[model samples]
Target: MTSDDVRHRREAGHFVRWALAQKIARDLSFPAVRWNGPSQAMDDEARWATARRLLHDDTLKSEDR
Candidate 1:
C-alpha cells in the first residue's frame, strides 16, 4: 500500500484508481486509506526503474544470508 500522498491524489483518472484498487486488494482487513484526487504526471519508465532497483536491492540483501 502507498502512503497518504498517493491516496490523496488518485482520483484524476483510471490509473490511479487501478493503483489504489491494487493496494486495497492486498489487505482488505486493514484500515483502508483510499486515494481521492488527481494522479501525478510521472514517467512510467522511471517508476518501473525505481521498482526494479528496489527489488534488486532486496534480492541482493536476502542473498547475503
Candidate 2:
C-alpha cells in the first residue's frame, strides 16, 4: 500500500481504540446516573457489553467469516 493508505489505516485503528475506550468509560460511569430509568439503562449496558464481546471474541470473529 502507499504511504497515504498506511497513514489512513493507522488513523482508523487509533480511532477504533479511542472509541472503544470511551465506550468502556461510559459503561463504567453509567450506573451513576438514572435519568433514562433503570430499564433503559440496563438495556444500554447490555448492548455495550454485547458490542464489546463481539469485537473482542476470537470465536465470534472466526464464525463471522
Candidate 3:
C-alpha cells in the first residue's frame, strides 16, 4: 500500500477512536439535563451503533475526514 493509504488509514483509525470516546461520554450523561428527552437512551444507542458500523465499514475508510 502507498504512504497516503497508510496515512488515511491511521487518520480514520484516530477518528474512529475519537468517536468511540464520544459515544461513551454521551452514554454516560454525567450532567442529567431536563431536556434529555425520552429518546435520549435510544439516541445514544443509535449513535454508538452508527459509529461502530462506520468505523469497521471498508467503504467508510475512504470517506472519513
| Pairs clashing within candidate 2 | none
Give each prediction's root-mean-square deviation over alpha carbons: 12.5, 14.2, 15.1
lDDT of each: 0.57, 0.56, 0.57
lDDT of 1 by residue, 1-65 (tens): 34555653334445545656888444323344466754886599977886787777755665552
The TM-score-based order of candidates, best leading, equals 2, 3, 1
lDDT score, candidate 1: 0.57
TM-score of each: 0.26, 0.30, 0.29
Q: What residue pairs clash in candidate 1, if any at all? A: 7-35, 11-37
TM-score of 1: 0.26
